[model samples]
Target: MTIAEVSEKFGISQDTLRYYERIGLIPRVNRNKSGIRDYTEEDCKWVEFIICMRNAGLPIEVLIEYVELFQQGDATIEARKELLIEQRKLLIARMEDMQKTLERLNYKIAVYEQVVVEKEKELKRSEN
Candidate 1:
């Protein structure tokens, strides 16, 4: 598929796709005879993987390193696994922190809700 098609299909900007290639975050996409990018199935797979990793909050440098390792053939299998494991650990820690923040916010909202209900009750009693 052309870059435009890939961009639309993946919900990513064309410029970002080009930037990914320039930054080595992804392998170079092959171009057609007219010198336009024509992403193959493998290229699309890389795009999907990169997007998923990025959405998971993986650092760009780490992703670039991972892509480089992937290009280095089978010798980097263990290294790649280790990298993914470390990233997963960090992501879990971040998720835990976010969960705590969410709980705190929920607690604050509940307190406000209770206060509002009590104020409404007081107003009703005064009217009565």
Candidate 2:
């Protein structure tokens, strides 16, 4: 498929696809006789994998490193696995931080609710 078709299929813009290609995030795409990009199923599969990793909050640098390792043949398989493990650890830490933040916000909201309730009671007493 063409760049436009791939972009539409993935819900991403053409520029993004080009940027991904430029940044070594995705493997190089084949070009037609007209020098237009012609994406194959394998290319699209790689793009989808990259997109999924990105959506999971995987850093671009890590993704780049992974891509490098990937292109380096099967010898770097262990290293790539280690990188993924590190990313999982970071992701877990991030989730923990978010949970702490959520807890704080919940506590603050409870305080506000109590304040509102007390103020309402006070207003009722004043009106009596």
The lDDT of each candidate is 0.97, 0.95
Candidate 1 residue spans exceeding 4 A from truth: none
lDDT of 1 by residue, 70-114 (tens): 999999999999999999999999999999999999999999999
Q: Where does candidate 2 have its weakest 10-residue lDDT segment?
A: 56-65
Best candidate (score: lDDT) = 1
The number of clashing residue pairs in each candidate reads: 0, 0
In order of appearance, the predictions have TM-scores of: 0.96, 0.83
- Would you give me the overall lDDT of model 1? 0.97
